[model samples]
Target: MKKYFLIIVIFVVISLLGFSIIPKNPFYNINWSIMSALIIGLAMLAFFWNFEKQGVSSKEVALIATMTTLAAVSRVPFAIIMSFQPMTFIVMITGYVFGVQTGFMVGALAALVSNFFLGQGPWTPWQMFCWGMAGVISALLGNKKKEFAFTKFIILAACWGFIHGWTMNLWHWVSFVFPLTLKTFLATYIASFPFDTLHSLGNVIFSLLFGKTFYTILQRFKNKIIVVPLDNNADIV
Candidate 1:
């Protein structure tokens, strides 16, 4: 519990400080946001490796892959709308149902795989980070609860939408704009508000309409696929 809280705090602090420092630092010639994003993404990958590598079953891996694929494909329909994507909805639900590691993998893989079609660039890592964080955070928030409520899910999704947009805006500010400032950040956020709102609303609507159904399906699948080996002594002779 404390470990998770510490990780979240460290990540948020690093991200905020990185955005503030990267633009002015003379040592960083290229886009600093990308560098920071890469570091953050790598750290998350490492965390997943260390924590889940030994215990994760084949069924869990398949489940993560399937969720990632669904999240990636779900972006296609909303491509025309700019920021609206069902990816968030899928990710939130997956995280809520599964554990943190599964959520992180689904979110990160969804970003990586989807970019093949959406055109990968510096923004890819940032997208991966934001979506991945969204899942991780959602899972953490729901850790104590047995069943998550629809309203809470919608609220969380909406909050993540803004967070996602703000994190994404960091790249553009660092790469295109010079000398990052609060004014510039505000401007970027203001410009992006509508799209972010769309994202939030999309998440809310998707979760509201399909949340229960998806939860049922995934819960059933989880139950059906899980395998527990019997103790050697329990075997009938």
Candidate 2:
């Protein structure tokens, strides 16, 4: 745990330092995105090393890798198919079942891979952080199974969407505006309202429709993973 804390601290500090040092929109081409993925993957590899010390199951690792990879690939299809976003739902469901640690990895890795195809930019790290956190948040929420209700899922998805929109807006906030004024921040957040809405709606609908099943499938790979019946058993919890 302490190692995780130190790692997070380093990542945050590096993120801020890189933000100030790297030119605006550093992720403009395919090469840079691939480079970024390589770099981020290295960092993730190290982070996972710590967690694996406690005996990381091969099933969990394989599941995260496969699911996240598929999630990454799905981004382009989502763009071509329904025009919906790629991965917030997938990662969140990942977090819900497999645990937050798994979700974070899934979200971050998915972002890393998607960046390769979508092209990279200064927003790469932030995008990685946002999607990764979706998984983490799912894990955090999932830990408290007592409150796992359908309505709560909507609220959580919307909340994650809002945060993601605002975080993405922060990139613009830094590039376009300076001094981080309240007016600028608030305006940016407000401007993201539409995307935020879709983000949340996507989460709600996806989670309501498939989160449990997806999560159920996700957990099946875990050692002794529990499978819950889909029938309405609100009182079960």
Candidate 3:
């Protein structure tokens, strides 16, 4: 547990330092997009390294890849919908079923991969972080329950929409918004309210429609991957 907490602290420290240094550094000619990507990539690597130390099975890696692909692909069709997408629901469900580590990987990878079609920018890292947090939040909320709580997840997903948008808005505010103040902060969030609402509504809808199905499917796969040991001295057929 201390190791996990340390990993989280490292991620936070690196992110804060990187973001703070990027805009102010005049000595190096670094592209904001590239620099930001590098920062987020390193932070994500810390988490992945921590996860790797846990001795992941090949089946677990494959499962994570499959879910990441699914989540990424799901976003493509909704690219034109202005913040409305099923990807979050998919990532959240993955996290709820698997655990936080898997959830974060799926969410972060989905953002990185899907941007191939959607266009990558400085926003890419922010998207990765936000979506990754979505997975973490879902896992925490589920609390290792064997059964999916549909109503609870639906509400959480709805709230995550706004949460996600507000978080992304912080990047915009800090990176671009001039004269950062209370008024500007409020304005930024206010301007994003409608889009955030759309995101939230989309999450609620997806959760209502597919949350249970996805949960059951993941749970089944999880059970199949468990390696049960045979009793010692058991007779062979």
> For each candidate, what TM-score against the reference?
0.82, 0.71, 0.83
- For candidate 1, lDDT tens digit of each residue in 173-223? 876776778898789889889988988888888888899899888778867
lDDT of 2 at 81: 36
Model 2, 55-172: lDDT tens digits are: 5667667877897888898786675532256478888877776777788889988988988988887777767877887888878878857434556666888688778887677667
In model 2, the runs with Cα more than 4 Å from the true position are 1-49, 52-54, 80-83, 144-148, 223-237
> What is the TM-score (0 to 1) of candidate 2?
0.71
Per-residue C-alpha lDDT of model 3 across residues 1-237, encoded as one tens digit per residue: 747766776776666566665665652444444555565666666776778788788998999999999999999999999789999999999999888999998998899899988899878888999899899899998876877888899989999999999988888887787777999999999999999999999999898889888888889998999885587436652
* Candidate 3 regions with alpha-carbon error over 4 angstroms: 1-43, 230-237
Better of 2 and 3 by lDDT: 3
Q: Rate the local accuracy (lDDT) of all candidates.
A: 0.79, 0.71, 0.85
**Candidate 1 structure, TM-score to reference:** 0.82
Candidate maximizing lDDT: 3
Listed per candidate, the RMSD to the true structure in angstroms reads 4.6, 8.7, 4.5
Predictions ranked by lDDT, top down?
3, 1, 2
